[model samples]
Target: MKTLRLGPWPAIATLVLSAVTLAGCDDDDDDDTPSDSELATEALLRISRDAPTELPDNVPEDLRRVTFGGTQYDLLELLGRPSGSRPSARIVAAYQTVDTPADPPPLGTPSNAVLPDYTRSAPAAQVYECRQTGGVFAWAFLQPEAGLEPMTTTPVPGLETLGFDHFRYPGGIDYGPPTGTPPVGPAWRVSALALNGGEPTFGQTLFVGAADVTVPNGAGNVPLLRLSNAARIDQGLPSDVFSRTTSDGTQVGYVLRLDTVGGVAPTAGCAGAGDVGKRERVPYSAGYYFVEVLTPP
Candidate 1:
């Protein structure tokens, strides 16, 4: 397996902006503060900060005041860490492009050429009861019932081209599922350390991705490896690596490839001109990691 190490410091401006925003909000309320409608408003502001630049005007007004189990939380608190498999009472938003032609087809004979017009799908909002009591939040995974089976495939259009789908935790790294297997619907992996103490220290997290090893023309199978304290330790290995760019230009680490078969292309390792070091990979995949943290009350 190959491992690449990324330098820690992110872009200055972005870091500064995020710090300022977080600092401003930290003063808004105290842990002992009672829940109020203002909490919802603050949450909305935080969510909007991370949302896409453009949002549909028709989005529900209450989207900013979503509640779980009869309790309302500000958006910053809701999104503070990795959301496990639990369904979000808040709107789980996504954008999709629908292709339509501006001009109709020719009248006489069918024409082969087609013009593509992209339309954004309306945002969707849903409220569910998935919050954990006592301030801790969890990622909920589905359990198979008697005579029922769990779903293993996810429906992602763009990732299919790359032969993998990316799985993300709320406040942690994003991982890729192996090609060929159906995506798992409600499976989640939690940080090992967080499971023990209810709160994970900075730099302590486990990230995982999945791939099907059962394709007819599949590449040689390799066992998924696991690592602890991925961001803080150095494991000597050469592997294919990946990284994600946060809004502030901080690059978060993801994976390192060990070995592969079946002519799959490796993505470029992290690189940029700056004081930051290159990103490195910590190879592993064991479903998803779920971490539940109790909010200060």
Candidate 2:
């Protein structure tokens, strides 16, 4: 079970361009026409990108072992073959851990009394079999497992309404305390989003709104966009709807891009102080909607 690490938040300008480019590319493709294998591969890549930092080591004891349908391949074997010239092309594995601490001891206990505590952890694994063909990397398969359950593609209802076309346990595996357990599967609730689009726009105003769905980490209550007036204008967009202020504040914004998958755009929106205090409003075209999770200090 290999751990997955996500890079820090991408620059605002880069994110905007990437989103525009992806939206454009998606517009050019046929709708809902991806092959079953292609769909599986896409899901695997999403899981890999969003997997947690660590996974439990106790195989069947604390973790489930599932075999994905269609193909069976070990981690070493998947990576041994050449993925291609591009750096994003390759098979990857990711592990996530979910845990919660036991409740605290009662107040009137003796000074020397020992306190009993309950602490437990569970693990989930997702594997991505992908390759870089024609300069763009795409997943060929996705396998997920939990304990000993048979691997199957279990549909998660309403996922598409939330902007996800497919949602599955992958290996027909689900693990956690029997119902009514606190903090159950908190750490294991991994969610991933991927975009394979064209070149991004240099200066554009993009809007992203969350579809009605269960918030991943009980964070649904938090506001989606927290914009600092100052930071907004500093990034080069409109100062009216977004501007800078003397008071220290935080704003919620969506990610514009995660990683570049195709030809790089000639020029991306400006970052740093180049466009500080300047206002620009660009038009938007229809395509795939951009989704990102952001927290500001």
Candidate 3:
């Protein structure tokens, strides 16, 4: 069979643009760590000039096997084709699991009520990144809309096993311990869903207040956003919350974003700064930092 080369696709860029708009920062200020409100206000303050670049020759080949440390070409060979593209960061190959019901089930419904009737849906897409050494593999990511999946009687190493619906690099690997469940109260909710309605999209209005947070417990040592005055316990906001699973099976939820000051630089003890690690301290004079409260489960 002839390999199918993917044409330039903009979906990834759209996703990045939407994300960057939320997390874009202004370096004019020299503050080491700015307040969340300050960053939020600044995010609104700075006008992002990054228009989506013109599409490139983003093509793909037939993917036979996907392995860690494989080249981008190797990935094309395994996944069969590329579905989306971003310049140097990554390429995406999308697979449609099946025609999902217009609505699967209201999130937060009783597991017994929904799980039995629910058919697993394929993740919208698989993101792949190329390494300096010319290898490409599935890149991990967090989806704010992905509802928290509680572990069954048997706990799995990776969160994906529970049908959490987030992306991970090297596939089937958990960053740390799995998040079970979190304490019930002290959560935040959206006053209004979004300007256009439907689940809130990026650049939409986000009204946050202390409410019951519904997402699954986030992994520890992950980068998170927090208000300057927020509590420092549990590594504070923007770091790790619900870092571990409780004996009773509860998962904690925390805010996470893909952008930061210095444009996702490398961190100590992290393979790449992009890897969700510990609370990322904005370097001195790094300017205003922006964060997005992860979407409710």
Query: Which 10-residue window of candidate 1 scores lowest in summed lDDT?
Result: 232-241
Write candidate 2's Cα lDDT for 99-148 as tens digits. 22122221111222222122222222222333445554444323222211
Off by over 4 Å in 3: 1-106, 109-161, 166-253, 259-297
Clashes of 2: 16
What residue runs in model 1 are displaced by over 4 Å at the alpha carbon?
1-54, 61-63, 68-70, 73-94, 99-297
Question: In model 2, what is the error at residue 144, expressed in angstroms?
Answer: 14
Q: How well does candidate 3 match the true structure, expressed as C-alpha RMSD?
A: 23.0
TM-score of each model, paired residue for residue: 0.17, 0.16, 0.16
- Candidate that beats the other on TM-score, 1 or 3, i.e. the better one: 1
> Local error of candidate 2 at 80, Å?
1.3
Candidate 1 per-residue C-alpha lDDT over 1-297 given as tens digits, one digit per residue, 9 for 90 to 100: 111122332244234334323433444454444222222222222222222322233222232233345676433334443533232211221212111122211110022212111111211111111234345433222121010011112332212111111222122222222211222221111111111222222111122333222212234332321111122110110111112111232222222122222222123332223312332222222221111122222
